[model samples]
Target: MTLSVSLQHAFPGVSLDVRFDAPQGVTALFGRSGSGKTTVVNAVAGLLRPDQGRITLGDRVLFDAAQRQNLAPHRRRIGYVFQDARLFPHLSVRQNLLYGRWFAPKAARRAEFDRVIEMLGIAALLDRRPGLLSGGEKSRVALGRALLSEPDLLLMDEPLAALDEARKAEILPYLERLRDTFALPILYVSHSPAEVARLATTVVMLEAGQVTIAGPAHEVLADPTGARGFGQREAGALITARVSDRQEDGLTRLDCGAGPLWLPGITAPAGAALRLQILARDVMLARTRPEGISALNILEAEIQDIVAADGDGSAVLVRLQLAPGAGDKTAPEILLARITRRSVSALSLAPGLRVFAVIKSVAVAPGAVGPQAI
Candidate 1:
């Protein structure tokens, strides 16, 4: 399913004018607070009408200003998951999940109740009430309820915002499963770079009510020039890898285009595909391969591009193409390094220069890794 949106809405100090296509899988609307992320979501859900625009999901027209067509929220067939679970406190978990069925027509209900419960791992909590559930548990139940509705698309508005780090970690796997297992497209709203790096297939970056960048998650995140939006410290590269083997020293080896990356013990099976987020700030560049170093990851890379330093001129962002074979014109894999401007001048770094990107094995956080689609 594809969701195309062209919207223009205005308020006292905010005027939103944006257009983007959300393809199947998770399309994350990413930006800071009050970036009109939720406004765009609301326009899709029919909760807020645009001053001028059109929203089409596949063949169905959800809103069209020219035609004066607007579907009611209930009739739009889009499941919404908010930051708060919004489950009925008095109702049992099962009851809360089943309640979504009330809005879904009998003939259109395609999501199996038992399957949703199992997918979200909420079968154990079915008999309990929302008041007694943990934050993670409530989010799962809420997700189950949304899935049970059998909507054409899913709208998630920062679903993890209300959870603490532990709860957020607890619920991330379920969300990943939802993306991998379901056919429905998801329009997810979040400001978190880590979440966007892990969950998003497509990222539409909004700033001050406008889309500053829109493209594949990896490409958008890898742009050194776009680092300001994500904050220099949080900017990074996303790499696709497969769990190749586990070592006795308590590390899981992943095979990527750049070769093996040994991370802290990953519980997934050897063949599982995973996505890893490597922060630019954690990477160090070397003109010559350094030996006898504690860092386990050092890949041969060529300078692809160098972005000018920020206002303070204290740092420079460099893009590196990793594992470029002999006579190979295109580098399929890339890594990012943020270093001092003085280092750039000292090494005389320029495009096409060969260098090594050194990364510490322990620098990668467990939360920055997640399952990728096979």
Candidate 2:
């Protein structure tokens, strides 16, 4: 079921007016801090009253200002996860999860207790209190609690923001599992590009309380000027590749839409598909396939588009389409590379011009790699 939201609200210094439809998968509310990501989610969760708006889940109306209808938070059947784990300090982990289940209407209770524990890997910590758990453990329990609520819609407001790098890495896989295993719509608020690349099926880019760009994750991130909302450093594309083999040299081979790519290390076994995020800043373009380059990964590509990089003329972002494989009928695979204006001028880059995308084997971040849905 699609979630449709059109809201108008006002703060002391800023106003919020935006609308979007979230399809069945994870729809990310992504933007910089104070970009109104949280406000939009709050309105949807019935936590914030909008000045005027209409919110609906399929045919069910949660809020309609003109009709004077608004469902209370508990009545909305939505589960929320905040930045902090917020597990109960006085209760054991299992008890805290059951507490969430308690709020779920008996008719709406679909999440099984033991299954949630197993899925989140929290069975071992069932007896521990919040104070005794590590950051990652606490996060898993918090997510389990939300799942146990058996919500039709899940609202996660930067759930990983409070964790350190190690902790964030630990919980990301579980988060991915939640997205893949559950049959619920998720409204996730985040500004991190890596997280969005790995998890978002659809992206709604908010700028100063308005929708700037909204589309599929790959289309939005692969846009030549996508850096408008995601600063240059964070702009990137996500690619799904299946592991073909692990060579004796230690590098792993991945068969992606762009053809075979060799990365430093990939632990997933053969035939396992993985999502990899490639930042525009880490990609380099070559006019021709340079021979004997240090970069082990190179793909033949054709220039698809070009636009100013970072809204400045000093540099440009070139969108490259991988040369399609024989009989391939899927959408063209895209990659973005940031380069100086001089490079574009010297190479005479233009639409339809052939080139090579050169990337180092180690440029891929292991933390950003996650299992792709089959």
Task: Provide the TM-score for each candidate, comma-separated.
Answer: 0.97, 0.97
For model 1 the local lDDT of residue 9 reads 95
Clash tally for model 1: 0
Alpha-carbon RMSD to native, per candidate: 1.7, 1.3
Encode model 2's per-residue lDDT on 1-374: one tens digit a residue: 88999999999999999999997778999998999999999899998989999999988899999999999988888889998988889999989999999988888776499888988998889998899999989888888898898888889999988888888888888888888888788899998888888888889999899998888888888876455577878777777788999999999999887688898768889999888888888899888788977888888899988888864589888888888667767677888888898988998889899999998889898876788853
Determine the C-alpha RMSD for candidate 1 after optimal superposition of all C-alphas.
1.7
Candidate 1 local lDDT, residue 140: 95
Candidate 1 least-lDDT 10 residues: 323-332
Best by lDDT: 1
Look at candidate 1 and give me any clashing residue pairs: none
User: Would you give me the overall lDDT of model 2?
Assistant: 0.87
Total backbone collisions for each predicted model: 0, 0
